[model samples]
Target: MLGCIWQYFYSSFLRFWLKWFLRHITGKCELQRICAGYKQGALRTSQIGKNCNKIIILTLLRFEEDVVDCVAQIMRHKNISEQKDPMFKVNLQQCLLQISGYNTLFAAVEDLRKEVFDSENEDHEKICGDLLMPSEKLESRITKQWGNIGFQGDDPKTDFRGMGMLGLVNLNNCGCAFQCRYSYAIVGINLTEMAYSLLRSGALKTHFYNTVAGKPEMQNFHQLYCYLAYEFNKFWVDEEPESIMEFNTYREKFHDKVKVYLQEPEVALILKLDAKN
Candidate 1:
């Protein structure tokens, strides 16, 4: 109860006066101080974003192309002088770009998720083929050979139900990128779901903000999937669950571990395919 009252008091009155006092002494607004003090990435960006007007942030989220204008507006509103602090403009612009780019990437990913996987589509066929059997051709589209890569049934198409083409794309990217010890396609699809959950919940912001300075692309998302695929395999090996049936339990444990990593300001969940130190 006291914490809640203190928070209310701070936001309602103390915060404004605190900022005013800081600006009076430092001759720098809160945003400028944040940009100057914190290094690039989520550490800087998240603080600047939190202090920004909600309306302006919403505009940037919708039209990432307007980030320059958004930053200019923020500078003007905050009474920041570019002549005195030249780097402030550049730093704040980069933060806005990273913030907006994440939203754009999520929208792009959602579009792919909504797209149904077409069996006759040559591009789709090729991606799946390259994933499951890069060295040879399938006897037929519906052949049981898909089981070799860990599809649950003779047909792989049905497996793309909830995730749609997003699952296939992630699966293909993971398969082409690494050698798997688990049921490859099944694990890839499962990891795709994991990736989607992380993206939707905004848990990926820390990783993306650290890695991509500007707009994050679909390829960035693919790289994240690869990271999860590789790390999860390593995790599975270390845990050595009784069988695949215990996947959910171990998967949740791994998810919690990754979440803990994300909480760190310097988190960058990249895949390093090498022997451990």
Candidate 2:
């Protein structure tokens, strides 16, 4: 009876550890195979490789602080009129730092433009066609789209959480020469979707390992078996949130629970009580 109880507890502990290891590497719960479709496109394409060459060149040239300041000024003028666009602003700042480290920024921007436009068109022509227009016409379009503006939903001017509008332009100007590749975009989108799933699934608890052991001869076999069974069943259970603000209000709850189980008195007491009762 004692041998069976020890075996059961040991097996349960091993399973818990295995699940924790899986969750850690896989980034929470098992994500759907949403990236399979894009994997071939991402790996087989030469577009990103070609664009990366320009990116490297631009990275080298834009290393100067003065050049970074100049680029930041340009970004501020072109993409950052409002204060609400923090993500755009942050990405622009990071790009400026990357550019300021090397002389490659200019080449990257040129390469990026080349990728975006047909070879038959000049860089100026391509930029004008895609991004710039007559001031009056631009103003008229803005007026029409004013109600559709702001940081919510799928406005092209601020879509993908404003990274599309602000980061794209600022990074391009700062010497990032890569156009959006289909595979890379798909990978990013799929990764975010998986992360959201893990967050919603309450799989966080399964990512922790716990173990208990005691003197073999003194163990109460029947009580130990029941306790191990309870722990094993509880391992897969999703915890309930008491309020909408529980994440914030109970910020340390997981850590605290772990601490209670792992600390001196609690761990021994739990085992002792299980053996006694």
Which candidate number would show the highest TM-score if scored against the true structure?
Answer: 1
lDDT of 2 by residue, 1-277 (tens): 9999888987779766865686577543211111111122212111222222344334443444644455355445444432543344343333333323212422332333234323244653334224432232333422443222221222223322322222223322321111221112212222223222321242211111112111111122222222332332233134555532443333244334533443332232132224523
TM-score of each: 0.95, 0.16
Error of 1 at 264 (Å): 1.0
Off by over 4 Å in 2: 1-64, 99-277
Candidate 1 global lDDT = 0.87
In model 2, state the lDDT of residue 47.
22
Per-residue lDDT of candidate 1, residues 1-277 (tens digit): 9999999999999999999999999999988899999999889988977887878888665676698888888788878888999999899888888888888999999999988888899888888876568887899878888888888998898898889999998877768443547567777888899999999999999999999999899999999999998888888999989998998899899999999999998899987878641
| lDDT score, candidate 1, position 31 | 86
Steric collisions counted per model:
0, 18
Candidate 2: 10-residue stretch with minimal lDDT = 209-218
Q: How does residue 26 of candidate 2 score in lDDT?
A: 53
